[model samples]
Target: MCTAYSSDCPPASSALHGGPAAPPAAVAAPVVSLREVSVVRRGRCILAVESFEAQSGEFVVVVGPNGAGKSTLLGVMNGFVRPAFFRPAFFRPGSGGPGNGRAEVLGCDMRSFGGWRVRKRVALVAQMVDVDARLPISVLETVMVGGYGRLGLWRRPGKALRELALSHLERTGIAHLAHRPFGQCSGGERQRAAIARALTQEPDILLLDEPTSALDWHAQRGILALVADIHAERRHTARPLTTVMVTHDLNALYHGGEGEARRTVPDRVVCMAEGRVTWSGPVADALDAERLTALYGTPIDIIRHGPRPVVLF
Candidate 1:
């Protein structure tokens, strides 16, 4: 079921549709690059990255113990940290994207691109909604914040823009709550709203840090399923969006494809420990009992009974 696409993103050429299984190219350009990166705060080391790359349309799971610096890593990728030795480039480590800032994306360096342009191509959904829930803003208006990167100012969204936001809401199954106040909703509702906000940004790189940590089991699965769906659709788009998720939901080898249904199997798994990589390989292999037990300091078992991944801690 692995399909390919062309430069213009026209559903891969007709010839490539039914052709023999050609190997997937190396995908030279990385949407995110962290080179020799190290972050320290309050005399504590957070991120000590040797190297890492997030390819186009790839789903990357960052897992580790509570203090593994997962959040700090996401912040650096989104340009919140200024790493002295960090050699980062959207396409390379020093390229250009939309504006004059150099941040190469979709296979180009972002160094020639600007922050405004870079924000257009990447959207970050924080782990928690720390803002006042008591704000009077309706859900629709809240979702509209995603468009701010593109709108660039106080300009309100037009009818078409509103429709697009609603469409995103419907796709996420939160359309009915559009009129509700932000803080009055349940945690799950707010989670979906955050996702809808990211969708409204319509970005290529979706960086999420611990998105499902606060939700119930069903809501966690729903959020992961939503992310899987979005990534699947990116397969046909020009930039071919990539999702970088920082999560503790270790249902290894379980991927739900774009609200379509859970995947019979996942593409791969990546595990981190002690601010360094412990093991990274295929999802099935990475999540084997031996490896996971070591990472979490507990006995672990992955059950294969359901369509979604289930792990017993």
Candidate 2:
């Protein structure tokens, strides 16, 4: 459910997973999990999540109204936000598979001060990153910054980092802008660079915060398609990349961006209102008109013309 400080809240992960008794034998352990999570700031509670879990290769879309703590959820998962009272656990594969259930991240307890190591394995793209118009960094260089966390203090980036960054930029359809000034790029181009930067980390889990926000409709469609392509390509590898994105883009929520009737919806949907989760299930179940209207506190109508359900106000 959402973590908003409001009267209504979405249900927790248990509502969808059914009590969470080791996640069944066939299913692998969730790569990210939070229990009794709570974050407070300035004598005010920001987020409070009872239970949240995301398995490997799962594409989760978190949708909620503004100030619902959607971005904070991703922040906590990617190790950026330190919760006031919570233990966010990560199950990483060790040689064979995700071994014994450990309440640790990157094999170290988050409370143990070595939790910074966990950040190297995760990459986060914030909703907005301000870029000065006069900044001189190239797009490729900007993306290479993602690898710096793994490189550490003394080590300098080499040819390998450049190549990796370029490859990701190409995948994100920004190879042509590799040598261009990062600050001069368009809104869509910048978002592409941000995604490429995240990919350059070779992260186990990718966190995207409103990646399509501020972009035009065409750019939004393009970016969403690019994300889908990245997910599909990674699914064939030994360790598939897991993704969690927060967005208000109805196109993404409905069918992973419009114009692709063949494209599949996200693996799961988590709807939040007032910082509390209201729905957690398949896309079909989460798109009910009444539920969405109540979540946003506005009148919403749904029209099912074909397979896709269009949301109208």
lDDT tens string, model 2, 1-313? 2111211222133234546565443334567766556667787666766567776668889998998889888766766676545433421134343222223332334443555667777798887667897898999999999999988799999999999999999888889999999999999999999999999998878888999888898888888887777876776466677788899975576644335522465788898765556678987777778988898889988888687777887
TM-score of each: 0.78, 0.82
RMSD of each: 7.4, 10.5
Clashes in predicted model 1: 27
Clashes (backbone N, CA, C under 3 Å), per candidate, total 27, 14
Query: C-alpha displacement of 185 in model 1, angstroms?
Result: 1.4
Q: Which candidate is the best by TM-score?
A: 2
> For candidate 1, lDDT tens digit of each residue in 1-313?
1112223442222234444796443434456665556676777666666666776667777888888777777766665554434333422555633322222334433333232345666688897855577798998988888887787577667886788889999988999999999887877788888889888987878888888877887888777787777777776566677778888877623755543236532344567766665566766566677778889999998776655546788
Candidate 1 CA-lDDT value: 0.68
The regions of model 1 sitting more than 4 angstroms off are 1-27, 86-117, 130-133, 252-255, 258-261, 264-266, 303-310
The TM-score obtained by model 1 is 0.78
lDDT of 2: 0.74
